[model samples]
Target: MAKKRSGPSGKRGSYAKGVAKREEILTRALDVIAREGYRGASVKEIADAVGLSQAGLLHYFASKEELFTEVLRKRDEADLAFSGFEAVPASADVRDIREGYLSVIRHNAEVPGLVQLFAQLSVDAADPEHPAHRFFIDRGALLRSVFADALARRFAEGGVAPRVPPETLARIFQAVTDGLQLQWMLEPDLDMAATIDVLFELVFTHARAASDDPPDGRAVREGGAA
Candidate 1:
């Protein structure tokens, strides 16, 4: 009668299974929350959707807030993975990054549920006590930083100065993206990608025109013409 062997392999197997179950729960939870919202989806409902009892779900996640926090984290991770930035060359400039954003927006259109989830959670997270408050705050800051850096790079590449500061431009860009997302949610027919492109064009054109102007309000003389 050999002694029971609970070796490293056994532990690894258990860990892998736990990881798989956790991901399954997160996936099902997203679907449930997308359909029912955070307040409407009870612990039991989420558990049942993942083929677990409420108590079993609690073993993996302490509470509904905890579960929802993990879900939001996973959602952001998924979005970053699909953002196409990783495929961009190291030599890529601001315009390249800006173009990448259009692909992300297009992808978001295909997942209205995820977009709705983000919109709803972002609103709910406005409360200081909410679990997702910090997430959204940090997310906004990160977006502003990335956009500012990209815009600055673009301006540098073209030897053009922006009419507005890069940070200010970044905020405006972020606001437009968020506002458009909300509008698109309400009016599904809205062309969010095209609208964002128009915004980029307007901002870039203004910056470029400003860069081309004479600082002393002097007009450029044409060749052999007044």
Candidate 2:
């Protein structure tokens, strides 16, 4: 019989394996970085945790910056999943989204090392040539867009009203969240989530007031919709 060719299936299997290993490395890296601050989580340390040599780890990523950028990307995906943004309801209530956002902030408090890493990388990524510069730029715009879009929906459908424009409010929220991370790092006792909640209340006072009104009022505003 003629020799059989493994062909595309072989290539696909190898690609799948490579992807799985990369994910494993990222997951382990998150644990290592969460336990050990960015300064402590050296390349060799991450390599050792993943049972790979420095060379092997480096082979997977073009550079350390690329690896860290991927780490932040993974963190974002995990955060979205945790915050219920991955599967938000078609008509999600503002209160529901607010709680989801607060939950993510609360989760961040438990991962101080990651926050430290993020703070450091954010500063470093300010350089346009840095590997993470694009990531941060794109991430910021996307986050602001998502928040703005969600608020716009609420304003139109949920009868919520805010003094500021949705886009501006989104930018303010992002700024506050990022600034709070730095403050929380300096003062561990800072209640970042609660502070954000208070900010939300102050900015969206009308939203809260509307939600609090009797069912009759909400029904009229929402046209008896959920």
Candidate 3:
């Protein structure tokens, strides 16, 4: 005899259950990785955390690498949502983006395990053979482009001539943020958000000063007239 076909409701129920199970697995995997770091967390441990056998977990994610990729993707989605940039606003400017970064840093501080996981994985992924190497590379490029675009827009709006190219500024911003994360991981008491704010202040102050200086090295008056 053939298996009986389920109705639309049955199909919907099955789909919903599958999605829930997938999210549950992702959540549990994040928690385990947070505590154990990517290299330290075993597939068996993750599966056990979610009450599944390793083989069963494999049914959802074929490999640990694939699972790690999904976790990183989910983490980005969550960060975007928390940053209030799930959908960019028409009025969003560089200051808005900077605030978003600060907000994310604050959020990460509350989840030290996740921070530790990210720091450890990022360093290990520097090896070309690592599973997350490509992910980090792509992520770095995307973030740099985003920061560059935001800075460029701000420059255009404020007529603040940038002493450095937008792309260069973006790289600087990314470097500072990543460096601060590593430092914060080592010294948990460090205020990452405040440190980032100081970096922004210095960068923007320099940009503003450059914009105010004439080509001949003379400082312009505040009233737009030299």
Candidate 4:
């Protein structure tokens, strides 16, 4: 007798199933990297967890370098949804501002491995020929643009003269966040969220002081979803 054929329920291309498997493997891959470090983690290890052959893992990610970049990218996109991901939106209420920032701080506070991963990859990417060099640099530049645009819009809406140009502030914000993340990895107990809160408070306070007057500053609102 022949083995029974399975129904479409066992198929791989279904939207829900594919997404679930993708997330599952991606998450496992991230863990492997965190535990083993970049050079230590391998596709075989990831495949073992997923019950897939090494070749099967490669089907999902062509190479280790590709997997590494993609894992980081996925992590960042997810992290953005956490607390402390604030942008200086023109019409944002306190909730949006708080969530935006808290998202950043919260991620910094936890996931020391991710912080380490970013630092290692970034430094390694310094050589012009390094595969990830351009990707990392471009990502940094893009983040700076986000900061600048947000601050510019806020300044316009509030009728406030920004103490520093938006571009300058954006660069500084990313620099400080990256620096703090590096440090926090070494010292996991560091209150990253509080530090970031202080950073925001200082920036906002300076902006308010620069005006030499106070306006109806929006109250911060919490925006991170569970």
Candidate 5:
């Protein structure tokens, strides 16, 4: 038998390189989409934004749909950044929640355009024929479940309280974030971070009263109310 070519590593390297270039193109392309609606965004347009000729951009991305799909996925992976948030004990003080909330607000500011893009594309991803349709739907469901679990864990100790059942509160959590993002997108001049801070303030105070928990650790230090 003729010797079989053993070139798996070469194929793997090629795949990795292709993926890297695709991501680079999509990373730049998202900004283009954010500024220009999907109708206005074409391969040539994105290529121009990144200083690439239309042909060169097309060589890496075969179609506008492919480019947009990759951009949406990259945006999700970037924004699904809630690490260390769940680590705060169910009994964590108000200060922990306050700090974690601040971190989330800071990250949103860092990617204002990307956040706006998601708020727009979310509707597009609902159609079954849309490339990212199923992915977005499934992701939304998973996120809701995960957040609900976190709320449940937090309240399980009886030291924490939620105005409604964790399941209902979970839906409220998603709705509030979505509505805020939409409003902020419409009016970038709005102080989204400050508004978020106020919302949390009200929520925490109510939870404290219902759970009969002590004031936050930092509140004790700064003479602030939880």
Candidate 6:
């Protein structure tokens, strides 16, 4: 006698299992990359850690580039969760945002391998045809938008006007962060968290000054009178 054929339920179960397995691969890959530098973390190592062969891992991801990109994507999700910035409330203080950003940097200082991967991928992703290109582009836009929204809200509510528009400030923040990461990679002793903290202080001070000075170059009095 022949064996029975499975129906739609079997297909669904298989699909669910495939998704779970892919997730497991990405999670394990993240750990591997974090522990081993980008150059050291080979596809075989990640596959081995996840109990999969190179071919098996490629079955889950289209290519090695896609796999590494997914790992970076997972890293971003983990960072957001760690910073708690995803759930920031309207009533939250602006300083909380600064702390969240600093915390992520501090965490990065501990994960040199992921940082290396990010740097390499970002530069390579500059090519339009690269697998990680879309990921980098989308990540930049999303991060800038989130930062801008938070800054705009805080500036309006706190009565402090920034020297630059919130959108521009957001770009500046992003650029400074990327630059600092590159610099830190070169100089392992660089205190990224401290540097960013000082940057936040400078930004806030300038914003406060901008808020205090009127358009006519007159300083606003204590009670808002020019």
Report lDDT per candidate: 0.76, 0.82, 0.77, 0.67, 0.64, 0.83
**What is residue 225's positional error in candidate 5, in angstroms?**
36
Candidate 3, residues 1-226: lDDT per residue as tens digits?
1125533557787787667777888888877876776667788898889888888887887577667777876788789888876666755667878878899989888777677667766887888987678888888888877777777887878888776677777777888888888898789899989998998887677667767765555543332111
| Candidate 5 colliding pairs | none
Instruction: Give a tens-digit lDDT track for model 4, residues 58-135.
Output: 676656666667778877766665534533445543324645766666755555556667787778788776656777
- TM-scores of all predicted structures: 0.77, 0.83, 0.78, 0.70, 0.66, 0.87
For model 4, state the Cα shift of residue 74 in Å.
Answer: 0.9
- Lowest-lDDT window of 10 residues in candidate 2? 217-226
The residue-by-residue lDDT of candidate 1 on 14-54, one tens digit each, is 78767778888898887787677555778889888987889
Alpha-carbon runs more than 4 Å astray in model 4? 1-24, 31-42, 83-90, 93-95, 212-226
Using alpha carbons, what is the TM-score of model 4?
A: 0.70
Model 6: residues with Cα > 4 Å off, grouped in runs: 1-9, 91-93, 213-226
Ranking by lDDT: 6, 2, 3, 1, 4, 5
Number of the top-ranking candidate, with TM-score as the measure: 6
Residue lDDT tens for model 6, 66-96? 9999999999999999999888886665576
Candidates sorted by TM-score, best first: 6, 2, 3, 1, 4, 5
Give the Cα RMSD of candidate 6: 6.9
Clashes of each: 0, 0, 0, 18, 0, 0
Cα lDDT of model 1 overall? 0.76
TM-score of 1: 0.77
